[model samples]
Target: MATKNNVVAFQYPRLTKENYDKWSLIMKTVLGAQGFWENVEKGYTEHDVAVMLNQSQKEASQNERKKDKNALMVIHQGLDDDMFKKVANATSSKQAWDTLQKFFEGVSRVKKVRLQNLRGEFKKLEMLDKKSISDYFGRVLNIVNQMKRLGESMQDCRVVEKILHSVNSDFNHVVVVIEELNKDLESMTIDELSGSLQAHEQ
Candidate 1:
């Protein structure tokens, strides 16, 4: 009997190409807090009519089904027509959730291709001449973050090494000093490396 507005007090943003990640996170958090996230993730299984269920079991099953319907309604209310159609045929909240992920989370094929392209960009990233240290770091961090969002595994050490190698020759002396001083490059954080580079640049 709970309406979508009554089930969720706050307005949940509709999912879009640019907002899918943020929207998905917020929706999951809200649903989880309401004890409906399991229905979305794993779905509710109907009890077999052939087996006689105790009164408590029957009541629990009915409650689970209600929760499933509510979860589906929450998802439906948050999507635009185009997005809604993606999961309109789903029989359960789990099916609807998986369908949405397939469409918006970039299917395996698309994600793989994107990951490759991002890796290439990361490899080609260099601190250009005349670019400030902060600007250069920002460029690198942008690529790193994009890679992370796409599920690529980027270690801090890998990023530190990449930045150290990519900076212009103006930073050659400092880079060498850092390499010598820090025998274990893996222990150096990006921020620490950036601070050292910024100091040299100034």
Candidate 2:
């Protein structure tokens, strides 16, 4: 068993002289036992490969656009909602970015503390791998088809069709952003997308 010390001296039956002596000897036999941080530092620096990996991980983490991902996901997920009701409605891009960053910061903090408790809930979910662009486009096509059907039913079908066309254009713009992100991901040193997914969870 391990214990964290908060005081120089404290009464403890568990620290009886005999057990204390044995524990002290045992601890000394352990490598780099001067302090817990010494052990932690040693562990993180043990091998050259490990050191390089850690450096890369840190660099990747430094460039993470976690907050950006969260905002994009938020906007995409909120597409069906009235835009005027969202935080982005009244704010400039900079202001909206700040707000979204704050929101995700809190979200990330909450997740950090409880991830262990929640990890199991995701263990049983099946992952869907990317099949084909056409398969991906199917959902988008479905929406287009639905809009076309709705446009036909309206008395002002032309007006409704125009609205659908505008929506399709917007979808195209979003697709461009998605494609840019995907391409940027390939050359990027680290998986900031994963950070963004973490933000999504947030």
Give all TM-scores, in the order shown: 0.54, 0.18
In model 2, the runs with Cα more than 4 Å from the true position are 1-84, 117-202
- The prediction achieving the highest TM-score against the true structure is 1
Separately for all candidates shown, the number of backbone clashes (residues 3 or more apart, or on different chains) is 0, 0
lDDT of 1 by residue, 142-192 (tens): 989989987888899999999999999999999999999999999999999
Q: Identify the leading candidate in terms of lDDT.
A: 1
Q: What TM-score does model 1 achieve against the real structure? A: 0.54
Weakest ten-residue segment in model 1 by summed lDDT? 1-10
Error of 1 at 3 (Å): 21
